[model samples]
Target: MTELDVKDWLVVESLQSGIPLTDRPYAVLAEGIGMDEGEFIRRTADLEARGIIRRMGLRIRHHQAGVKGNIMVVWRVPEARIEEVGQLLAKQSSISHCYERPMHPELPYNVYSMVHAPDPEAARVEVIRLAELTGIDDYKMLTTVRELKKSTPVYQRPEE
Candidate 1:
């Protein structure tokens, strides 16, 4: 697969806010980057195929969109069943992020997942359902009372 060129990176940077909502958004972006519409579309397709760009769409802040609570759930799943439970939890649309982490001998929690909902009760319900599905009777659900920091800056430095 061909790697992303300078123009491709420029296109991605330009799309951080999302593609323009004009009748011809791609064309607008192409013109901004001094490229024709066909070239812009072709480069975007190639970037996607190569997994350089995941998707071009709206980036919504859930809290601003009526989601009042964000919960981080940690489960003490048995080693043998971690993958199964993780997969099950990941399949739920309520789960915005999910992953398995190494558990310390002193700390028994391993599998971790995140669920965002309109309220704490809704988030708790989803976590309870996950526990039932995974047969994880013991788990800790930590709801963020306040967001300290929640911004992901665009990384500009390339690894040496």
Candidate 2:
């Protein structure tokens, strides 16, 4: 991995808060961070190319966006059918994230997906739809009652 310089750290810190919601978001961000728009863009591209930044995209604030129903449905998918079932779940627009995780002895579920809707009941309906679509009914819905902390990891210069 390429080492990040001072400017790269600045760029990372500036971006941690999120890109400005504006007509010219990049320009606004670059100006705020005191860098030329082209340079800022180039540095961002370089960070991505070097694998320092794995992914960058818009993140929807589900709660603020009037999406009250958010549930994480964990499925007990057969090891052999993990891929097939995971793909089916991923195709649905309501499913934000779907992945196969290592299962614990106590918790037998392996496949997990984040489902969102307008309300909690609707979210449950979506979960049922998913269960039917994937044919994997042995599952659990983990809903968030209160979000204590939700934030991106802020990068800081390491102490020598």
Candidate 3:
């Protein structure tokens, strides 16, 4: 198991809440956690290097950003070509996410991608272009009718 001191835990907690929208967000966080900015950065880098912290990224509000169309494209990639096809899908700027999932009898498509576009027509064109680029014709594009829920995960430490 990974060992983390109270200060490290405090850093994690501070990060979990949310990154401040400022010119020097990291410095602000470090100050709040009573750690020097350089030390905080070093600790974060160390955590990432050790594989404890995978990655930190932002969530784009597509709707608010004039992206009215969202499509989930599921590709029927051959087992032997899953990784290659997934990489192709991931390279597209329109495709925000690409993932491989277990193949079930009912649903044979294994590789899925989330595509964002200004409208449905553009989204379909992008999907068609993706199919041509990847040479994977077997796929389905499920359009978003409505978004029921979307939120980020919040982590909490066990009571000590």
Candidate 4:
């Protein structure tokens, strides 16, 4: 893992939630974090190359964009064909995220997906279509009854 210095952590903390919406957002951010624009850009690029930052992009609020329903679909995919099925599900427009995980003693599901839609029925319809497309019959949808927490994890050095 790439280690972050104090200044790097400060920059990460400043951008943990959001970036300024402006013509020169990075310049504005660097000013806020007490760094010049050129250094800020260079450090960000270095972080990316070192794997300290995997991705930096906008996370659109699905509900704000008129997607009202979101369901967590867990599928019991056979170990033999997990890769093929996961790739197919991940490619779907309706499926925002698809992951393959290990099976447990009690839990039979190994593949999971998040499907968001305009309504419950729409989400269910997408799940059905996704099941057909992935060629996996065993699956279940855990409806998002309550949003307890939603956040992006941020890391910073403890104050000395």
- Write down the lDDT that model 2 would get: 0.88
* lDDT digits (tens) for residues 33-89 of candidate 4: 789999888888888788877888878887888888799999998888988898888
- In candidate 3, stretches whose alpha carbon ends up further than 4 angstroms from where it belongs are 1-3, 22-28, 31-38, 48-58, 158-160
Global Cα RMSD, each model: 2.6, 3.0, 2.8, 2.4
Model 1 bad stretches (over 4 Å): 105-107, 155-160
The residue ranges of model 4 lying beyond 4 angstroms of the native Cα positions read 3-6, 49-51, 158-160
Error of 2 at 90 (Å): 0.6
Please list the C-alpha lDDT of all candidates, in the order they appear.
0.80, 0.88, 0.87, 0.85
| 60-125: candidate 1 lDDT, tens digit per residue | 888779887679999998889888888989898888888998888776799888887778888888
TM-score per candidate, chains pooled: 0.82, 0.79, 0.78, 0.83
Looking at model 2, report the run of 10 residues with the lowest lDDT sum. 151-160
Q: Indicate the TM-score of model 2.
A: 0.79
Residues 1-160, model 3: lDDT tens digits:
7887777777788888778899988899999878999988888888788887888778678778898878999999988999999998888899989999988889999999999888989999989999999899999988778889988777566579
Candidate 4 clashes: the total is: 0
